[model samples]
Target: MKFGVLLDDHLFPEWRFYYLDYNELKRQLKVRTAANPQGKFAEQDEAAFVEILERELEKVASFRALKSDELERRVAHAQAAVDSILSSSDKPNETRMRAVEDELNKIATEMTELSKFVRLNYTGFMKILKKHDKHAGFQLKPTFMVRLAHRPFYKEGDRSVDSLVIRLSRLFDIVRTGGIRPPAVLPGGASQNFVRHTTKYWVHPDNITEVKLIILKYLPVLVFSSKGGKEFDPAITSIYLDNDAFELYLGRLEKTEGAEAIRIRWYGNMDQQEIFIERKTHREDWTGETSVKSRFAIKEKYVNGFLSGTYTMDKTIAKLRDRKQKSDKELDEMATLSREIQLSMLKRKLHPMDFLGYGFDHEEDIVRFPYAVLEVKLQNQAGSESPKWVTELINSHLVEEVPKFSKFIHGVATLIESRVTMLPFWLPQMDKDIRKEAPKRPPTALDLPSSSKRHLSVSPSVEVIIDRPSSVASTSRPNGPVSERTPLLARQEEDEEEDDDEQEQQKGKKSSDKRFPWRSLFASGSGTSLHIGAGGSAHPNAFLNSMIARENAGRTLQQQKRIVLPVRVEPKVFFANERTFLSWLHFCIVLGGLALGLLNFGDYVGQISGLIFTVVAMIFMIYALFLYQWRAHKIRNRDAAPYDDRFGPTVLV
Candidate 1:
């Protein structure tokens, strides 16, 4: 759609007057150009356009400042209220708590709308400036953009928004848990067993604040700290390593099994001394192994020498060993990992491909990603099952699932566009708007108190959902080609409903022959079955379909309803069992060979000894086979039986 229409459609109705007059500006340009009938605009016409543009900019900036200040005061008031409640010796007032929650929700909603408001207006100003420069043949954009930068509303990374979000998250967290504060990090720290199933989604810039607000309700904002100071932003800068041949890039792009990506990453900024040399190895599902990520820290000063193969981690390992902070086993593992990484880098001739930084100074070959990547990581023993809230958030219209989305691949494609033959599927989708009309949510039981529900007996006003117009027409210009300078103003499809439907239909057809009895899973208690429509098909949204599948599968599993959750048996467990079995078999083989030697080339006493040895060897072989099968079964069934043999090994010895 045209910038004017888009601005009108998405602008907060209450603050509609504050937005730039994009249509009026366009009209002014048309009239002046028609009157002149020439390419160049008169001095008066140019000045007129500039005056209006300046006025619009001033209007937007003032409104943004006012709203920001109001939001700050409201946030402060809410914080004080929360503090008072927490410090009180008396029982907590239910009414007061509810009121606080309501206020917080309102503030969150307003903040989201304000962010949207700022973004739309900023885009409007840019679009208008571009148009004026093109039609009037005046170079006004560069100068105006500088002025726009001075306006805080047009700038990215507003600290006020970040601070408010953090404060609101803390407040909501306390309220959600009934005044109990959770720890910054759980007990056991890095040693904790976290087998999380991570999924990535691409969030449009317009929806980032709202998405953050929704996520903050369930998960707290995780802030990192270092010897430097508390790094609240937790920004990361990584230089991905690949060769001139782009072998690693192709491997990662194709998601080939055992594909490895190496990178030198640092948190906060380049000034930080500690840098992490990280490697990620991709494993296919058929291999029964999940992808793994491992990293070892090194000083920033040593990075150049290490990459050049002139330095090894020997000195670092020696220091660690001398300090006695790490176990001998850990030190060995670290040394081994370092050696492997160094060897791989040297052998493959790996070098830096692209620089990926977050909230930091941009350097050469840096490709700033347009969309915010939201990774939902859930730690569940049952891989398919997740918390209801997380499921809802993923299924919501706020996110677009881009499976196996890699920052490295994106950077490579964007930075060296001419070099790479194959581009990622999402490359074309970058221009498309991922926004959709917000789904109307039914009031859940947890939404409000009984008293609040009683007040909602009156009929609600009808909410008209406006569908955005097609952008293919609006983006076309009669006089000339579209400018590549303003990517933000590029044409975009309003939605992907048709494409999504076709994809879902194909998936449905493929799974039709072996459709799981999803309805039966939910039929017992509620006497209601989840109707997935004809052909057992799902909704257009992929996340929603997966959630439905998970819900069905979870309900079907009898263990899911149990009080205690079962421990998941990883593929490594089975490998460990097999290794033990092989060791036993190895011992048996040695004994058997000795027995045969004695039987063939010794006297009757030797022969008798050989017979006993052969018999013992046979027993051991049989025992090893039995143990392997037993352990395999236990692991497969997730049995809580003890795996260790307290006396078997002793007796055998």
Candidate 2:
């Protein structure tokens, strides 16, 4: 009196009651009732065949209580009792409906044999949460209770063929603990869809403090859980889909409150992806559009791979500007804890930031100069606010990728501090637009050489210390490391220094009319000083199409040897203007103890008395560059500028 396979609340019944094997349905109904060929045995034909099998076990309880033409009239009366017991039935409805679909596919291959024939026991295990991301929009799917659990009453072969793969365990279907799992149920010819912010998790309770509270409050890479983590192992997650060669699109979030964020918006350029607090309130604007500089010069001139690793040093950024605070249920529990932290950091594969760091223009290593690619742009206010000036990317050689949503310094700063705003925002924004003073340093073969020694796969001693004007660098450390391939005397001394740069571009084109001249202000012929001019005179015809300052002297030495900014010296040119007037009297006593310690404290301090005038402007720019290098080395034995020559130093370190 106990045969089962019933289902209702969106069908689930232990996969066709532990894959239909009531002794193989009573040995195929006792070989179709001992071959009943009118060889009658009437006790009223065995009590009307046990009252039609007790009215099909009173319609096997509730699979949504039958109907749908009573389950196609009980699968057409179990295919006319398997076509009146076999007797060579042709297509009698496809051999009696493929013998009742071979008994519902041997009950879906014994319910795809779960970890073991189901023995489960769980109760109310709970978890549910939501946060303030920057604003809010989340969405989940469920519809009804997925599982309640109390089955209790075993029988049929008393269950245990090696416990059939433990009933597809999510530790027996996770009864939540904070948030993120409830979704599955599709089955009947399932379509296979999946994707949701690069998730990763394992090590049970150690969600590294819940994935460092979603990378310090929602920057999310991914997250997911359905148990399976007791100190981490079997758990693995990856959902990046969209297929057809490469569609890879993902969008599903909910969280945002305090100072609100998420402004992405890019369709054609700025190459997209920058939320790390808009790279700090637009620190001189334009953040990520996804670029690595032709993928780090094609992984260092054609797949040698390895762009940056030991960058040393971290915080010198004493806060230029950044603020977001989090709210939309903390960026949806940081996109559900960055998919268990990129599958617990085993993470691999993201490609295309010009295919990782840089790679689009390889006519071959041989750096002659003037051919580059990776450009990306998208800084949003919305509706393509054209104050104009994308001029088909003015004078393109490419590699632009500009986005600039802002905040860039604090976190999401990888690819080694974004090769300093991708080639200085692809060349030109100039001065305290905070890459701090620009014209940086390094590269000098006559302030950047190698015009062409048959593009000989590079390194003729870096075309001879950036090519030549003559200081002493002979090339090898433009901020450290290089000098390996040596020979053909750097291609026969770079073909006698490119036949001396085509006889000095034919004597500077007969002394002054050779036009292609702005070769990035000659990459550094030492013309220096780009104080955004005409406001102080640089006149190549006064702001001539604006990155201003021209008529070459290497236009401030290739715009201060272009790495595009951060290195522009000036603390009143190394101090002394009377120790910047006694360092503004100790910067007004740390700006009155950081505005009364942020009006009498709030959390972990009034954030340290609201940063005591950023440690009194970096201890008055390091004791006014150490009382002007201790009175300019007691009036001039010359020594003080060095830590990469500028930037990180209020005093030193």
Candidate 3:
């Protein structure tokens, strides 16, 4: 959809007047450009366009500032109420506690809307400016972008939003426990656990706010601050290193056993003196070892020298030892890691390939990621299950799971597309929007009042009628009565309700083609058996469709308590299987030769033993061939069944 239409669709009904006049600006540009028969605009025409653009920018800026202040006050008020309820000597009143919870919910909803408001207006301005530049043949975007950077509303990384999210999380935590806030986990606390499984998912920008609200109910946001303030910088910058062959990139992309990625990373900002030289090693589960990440911190001044093999970490280790800042074991480990990384860099001729994150001074290529990545790290005992909420969030429509997603690989693939032989599976998905229709959730105690329900019901894909008079439709739809123009909001609400009802009605209905479709696909070895549902039709790319099918199949297998292998089936895996088969055949040939020798050179008893040995040799050869073919078939079809044999080896012996 076009930006003009999308802007109108996602507009906050109560604050519609504050949005950019995108359509009007476009119409004005057309008229002004047409009057001048030449493509270039006259001085007066350019001035007129600039004047109108300035008005729109100012209007959006002022309104955003006003709304931001109002939201902050409301958050402070809610925080006070929460403290009162928590600090009371007696048990808090249930009604008061519920009221406080509702208030926080409203604040959170409004904050989300305000964020959307800022984003839509900023996008509108950019689109309109580009149109003006094209039609009038002027170079205005570069200068105007600088102007936009100075405006608070246009700054996409405004810290106020993060501050409000953190505060709301604390308040909601207090309300959830009825007076006690759960202990906050330090940012590095998860490192203490030796074994952890980290899964990454890409969150669509439209659903980021709602996703945060859902997670805040269970875990508090961890922030690092030097002055003990609520504000914290969330930026992390890293420079990935690789050779001209991109051996590290290929290794990491293929997920080869013992693949390693090297990078220099820093947190917060570029001015931070401390930097980490890190390496991530990938280990296959068949190796009976887990993947691990190791890093050692070094001063920023030594990075270039270290990479060039001029600086040694021995001096740094000695200084740390003398100061007693690190234990002897810790110093030794750091020294060993530093020496290994430096040697690897020099031997492999590794240099900077890509830069990730924000605000870097390097001359290397940098690519900004369009989507937010959420990493859920869990440290649980063996055979333990993930938390129910974590599982639910992963399955929800708000996020799309991209297993084994590597930032270095993505950066390299996107920045140096000409050099990359093959792109990652998730790269094709970038062209398509991952946002889906929000699922219908039952109302809870924290749900907003009826008057605010219309705001929550607006869908990103729903078309809203925007031609109505400003006076008649100033706010969201009312619950009491209806008017002619109000039907748009009413229809939206009704459609959502109808959707919920349809879902209820379809619970009992069954379709043979839809049930176990993945299983049938695996069994039949063809994509033709797959039924194209509305969701499947939306994603026309065959590769994306297959990925979705594999994910669904994996989820189903998980529900059945079965072992699941990697979804990606690389060609090397088949080669490995073939190699194993050849080894077994060689052993069988040796056994057959021994049986032949015994049969030819021995007496009757030796001949009888030779016959028995020959029979066993034949059985062994047959079993090995059969097992090889079966495993090859499974690997080709990308089956998720367990590959371990419980009785084959014992029975063969």
The C-alpha TM-scores of every prediction are: 0.60, 0.16, 0.58
In model 1, which runs have C-alpha deviations exceeding 4 angstroms?
1-5, 21-55, 90-95, 126-152, 178-195, 227-231, 308-324, 327-329, 354-368, 417-422, 428-653
The per-residue C-alpha lDDT of model 3 at residue 101 equals 73
lDDT of 1: 0.63
Please list the Cα RMSD from the true structure of every candidate, rounded to 1 decimal place. Answer: 17.2, 34.7, 15.9
TM-score of 1: 0.60
lDDT of 2 by residue, 515-578 (tens): 3333222221111112211111111222232222333433434434323222322335444445
lDDT of 3 by residue, 228-340 (tens): 34446544556789998989987887676788899887655457677778888887665568888888887889989998999999999999999998788888877888888
lDDT of 1 by residue, 1-653 (tens): 35565666677778878888878988898898778968668999889888888888899899889988898899899889988987884566667878888887778778878877876776666666756786788899877866765664654346568788888878776665557775554211343122445677877656677777766655556554464234454455667899888888877776666889999876554487878888888765546777877778889899999999999999999999999978888788778888989999999999886432223221111122445677766545434455555567678777788877776786666445445666676764553456666634334222432223223222121111111111100121222112222222221211211232245553563364124322211111110111221111111234234435664665445222222221334568878998999999999999999999999998999999999999999999998998899887666555777987777778877
Q: What's the number of clashes in each of the models?
A: 0, 107, 0
Which model is ahead, 1 or 3, in terms of TM-score?
1
Maximum-TM-score candidate:
1
Score residue 266 of candidate 3 by CA lDDT.
68
Looking at model 3, which ten-residue stretch has the lowest summed lDDT? 464-473
